[model samples]
Target: MRRREFLKGCASLSACSLLFPSFVFAYSGQPLKRYKRAHLVWEDGRPVKAKEIKPEEEYLFFYPFRATPCLLVNTQQKLKGAKLRLEDGKEYIWKGGIGPGRSIVAFVAICTHQLSYPTRERTLISYHPPGKKSSLLERDRVIQCCAHMSAFDPAKGGKVIEGPAKDPLPAVILSEENGKIYAEAVLGRDLFEEFFDVYRRELRKEYGSSKKAKEEVNRCVTTPLRKYTKEVIRC
Candidate 1:
């Protein structure tokens, strides 16, 4: 190619890079965009206590079980991990332990695979020691999704064991308070909540339809991706 042509192309690419550096790296080695997370307060108008959470306790009002800020009171002692969601829209790498006589070790509740929300509704298989089989029983550790069979050690910063997931779940900063477990700085709680509300309504409307419930559901699912592009890309 001519030198003039090459110079012009370089100039054009440089300008474009300056404009959307985040998108450029999104495909290669640039890290995923990390946003600031605000602290999550409990329904009682107090900061989340970081003490051992009991089983059957609700952390986030939306989901139940050991997912995201949900309480899991166990009777074992050792380092453990679980999938948890912070109030923020981002996931975390949570790890902790249940003192031998202690009650439980809790963390965020998000699947390591594409951030799919895993629940106690099903069993999730995970790899704890980086490449070992770790069955995520609803009653034991975090409910790892069996979709791709990803394992995570809650005590070890929710590390991925054997699966396609590359990054560990984000960890919510935690602290103990007055004998209660308090979670701190959930990545994307409020935004997800808001988005979830609108998304839920649309899904309900679509599902409530009898003739094309499946079609409606598919549309409802993809609708957010469209909306997200509109808001982020300003299209």
Candidate 2:
């Protein structure tokens, strides 16, 4: 099936968590994107307290406009010694959520493989560490999607530990202000087709059962090619 059709079917089946990462930019040596977002409050109308997040368990949350699902896992210890490789051959240490013993890190919850969403529903596969007969060590403390068996390390800037995804899960940078954690920026590509696909769905609603109408609705942004490779990936 065509890629678009496959994605549509996945959406219908709620199989949005298959890790089909098409963020494939020839990143042999290049720079990824940098970003900062406005104040994003919790959908539940309360600050996520550090005390509530148990060790090695995940806390799921949504963002502005409910555009995407973000996965937060607290390791009870600060995430340390993880490598963050930028597209531009730069590397850095990411202590996601400050220091050890209160380390809570968030990642783009959409599976990079197919831009699929992982859930606690039937798709839920309990976390299994390495050395298990069927374990995929890409490491522990991960956000896993059973759909395509894609896994990502939430503590390590969403790096693909093991899966078909070529790129890391786009890091949703978080910051603490006035004693509350807020997503400050996205330090990589946009969630696959988030707004663009929304427009496509809206167009379908506007022009039901009309192929010509669907064809007539032009997309504002096609998948764009990078203009410059030397741009800096902000931390």
Q: What clash count does candidate 1 reach?
A: 38
lDDT per residue as tens, model 1, 15-132:
7555434222322321122322233344444544334233323233212111122222232345544454332334543335333533343334455454444233322322122222
Using lDDT as the measure, the top candidate is 2
Model 2 regions more than 4 Å off: 1-44, 86-95, 99-102, 119-139, 194-235
Model 1 / residue 94 / CA error / Å: 7.0
Model 1 misses residue 76 by how many Å?
3.0
* CA shift of 225, model 1, Å: 28
